[model samples]
Target: MMKRAEQKGVVENEAPQTSQKSKKQKTCSYGSVFGECDLHSSVDWGNLPHHVILRVFQFLPLVDRARASSVCRKWNEVFHIPDLWRRFEFELSQPATSYLKSTHPDLIQQIIKRHADHLQYVSFKVDSSTESAEAACNILSQLVNCSIKTLGLISTAKPSFMNVSKAHFASALTVVFVNSKSLSSIKIDDTPLDDPSLKVLVANNSDTLKLLKMSSCPHVSPAGILCVADQCHGLKELALNYYILSDELLLALSSEKHVDLEHLRIDVVSENPGQVEFHTIKKQSWDALVKHSPKVNIVMYFFLYEEEFDAFFREETPVTHLYFGRTVSKAMLGRIGMNCPRLIELVVCANGLQPLDDELIRIAERCKNLTAMGLGECEVTCRGFIEFVKMCGGRLTQLSIMEEVLIPDNDYSLDRLHLEVSKHLGRLWFPDMMPTW
Candidate 1:
């Protein structure tokens, strides 16, 4: 009986070894090269369809795609596909300052050599370093044969492109501007993009340019922006600083030859608070623009002191979106409620100790189109805020109120404020709680 038991144990161990061998063989069968791949095999990984491989490559980052291409000969071919290179963003950075991974120089060279013509939508993301900006400019200088359509030069932190030589930057940028005849969208904010370069850009891509966002560009004057408005009649969206906005530019855009504007963003930044006096647009010019492009959404951003707001919202402004980035007064808010009838969105970052109950009620009474609102370091009684929500009801798509902004009153407590606001908003709502840590 002991001998029988020993034989049974040996059989059990041998059975597991045979099963392990079968699994190993099955794994190896799918791991072979494409040349040895069999379509009839139960599972043939190397023989996946070309489109399938391309789809897989699309989801991978550039570096990982390069590594994955070396897995097999077929994958390497897919890596070089023109479709994969159509839209590429070159990330240029230095290790000392930026945490972003810089694109490998060799890969960039390879792309410029092999896939420059295939590029259509391209962007350069650089850190706050002159060296990285120089590298990006160098790459742009080499893309002489490319036909990029949409181009964006984004600074990860501060505007580092300002450190680059203006001549070098303009020359390199002119290469793409001159070559790409069908360029449509360009965003070159916070760069030393002067009026001369702006002329080159409009001279080349005037007919095809549709959207241009060039804000925080001190070098570009009102004449440069006016030139763009006059020449690029196909422009649908425009964004620039308030200093560059002129009544003549608005009149030029309002001409019959120009297409109806869709969106306009004006940044009212106060670098020198008391010294900077902003010019107001004539009401006739605004009326003409409204008559020409009645549906245009005018967005205004105010990053100025309380006194600096006197020039704005006094007249019947057509501003649809208004944002107050500094300490705004109750009088300013009251002015917005009275003048801005087309207001759709409002965000107030800071308000003094005065509560905005009357201003909120007036806005709810007048601005029928108000859909979104956000209040930060401001005071509003929980009862008043609830009343405002109730008056705006279901139409208020976005209501963002800070927890501290809403003071608990007799009718409303901290616990019940959200429940009341949610009922009127037709969605579950909660005040943004400040993080303890």
Candidate 2:
């Protein structure tokens, strides 16, 4: 009987051992299915191919990418790849107001120290804070050795760059203009960019500059832009305020030595509309531009009162994209329908209570190539909008009409409007509704 008790005790001990082994086997089975296999323990993840690691790092944000470089020596090498630094945008914002986290100063220093020459397409995006603009300028000033190809200074809320001193901003920008002799595109809008800095840009980057957009630059006179047009013969796209757009500039762009311009945008804005007298571009100059570059798109944006519009659309103007920001009169839109035959897209932010039924129909008939339109703070009968849509048919690619713009007529109500519009559009269409909140 003692022997039998001993054997039973032995069986009990063995049973626990068997149960433990079963648990381990179960865990191993799960690991096999879920990629936690025993082999995973022995594999060296840090030994991944350089190209694979580089591609993964490319998708990471600046801060995260920098942290990821410390994972292994291979990743650190991938962090310094030239291709990864070719296109970079420095996002500058204040911590108090901006929801976005600013890029760490330490990382920016590391990039400037190690990869400044690798940068090609660089841009500075700053908020409304002048401090952020100052930070951007500091970085720009440090990129004296950079061979950047494309540079843009974009302000999110307001032109914070305008707050920077002209001397500080110009000196910082001159560093880039001097170093980046091959700059092909530049967009420095709403800044204190003066004539001397512009001349510096033309002197260094004229041979390679292709597109220049410096609208709302109050310090840059017409002569400054004329220098760009005269020297940068390869320029294909230009944008500037109306005050800087002169007959001489247009004629310079139309010269035989200059390349065919693809786009020209002019912003006509006045704080006190009637007080500012806008000079008109002569028909002869416009004709010369069209004769030289037949396919050029002349886009105009007008923000003026009703009386301030007398100088515009008077004759045959080649404006393709037109926008009226403030309240425009019916007579002005009538003039548009009569003169703007090459109109492709139009946006009218506000018009008076007049039902634009006749104007809508007229635009549809006259502007044959009109594909995109947005109307707001305006009145149009449902039937009139439907007729305009029918005339435009499926050719109207983008039709953004506010729901309030439509006044329900006896025939068509707002409830049934989308169905008719969708039928004509060959796709689903709905009027933009104002949010209740």
Assess every candidate by TM-score.
Answer: 0.89, 0.87
lDDT score for candidate 1 against the true structure: 0.85
Q: Per-residue alpha-carbon lDDT of model 1 for 243-318, expressed as tens digits? A: 9999999999999999999999999999777979988888788889989999999999999999888888788888
Report every candidate's CA lDDT. Answer: 0.85, 0.85
Off by over 4 Å in 1: 1-42
RMSD to the hidden true structure, all candidates = 10.6, 12.2
Output the TM-score of candidate 2.
0.87
Question: Per-prediction count of colliding residue pairs?
Answer: 0, 0
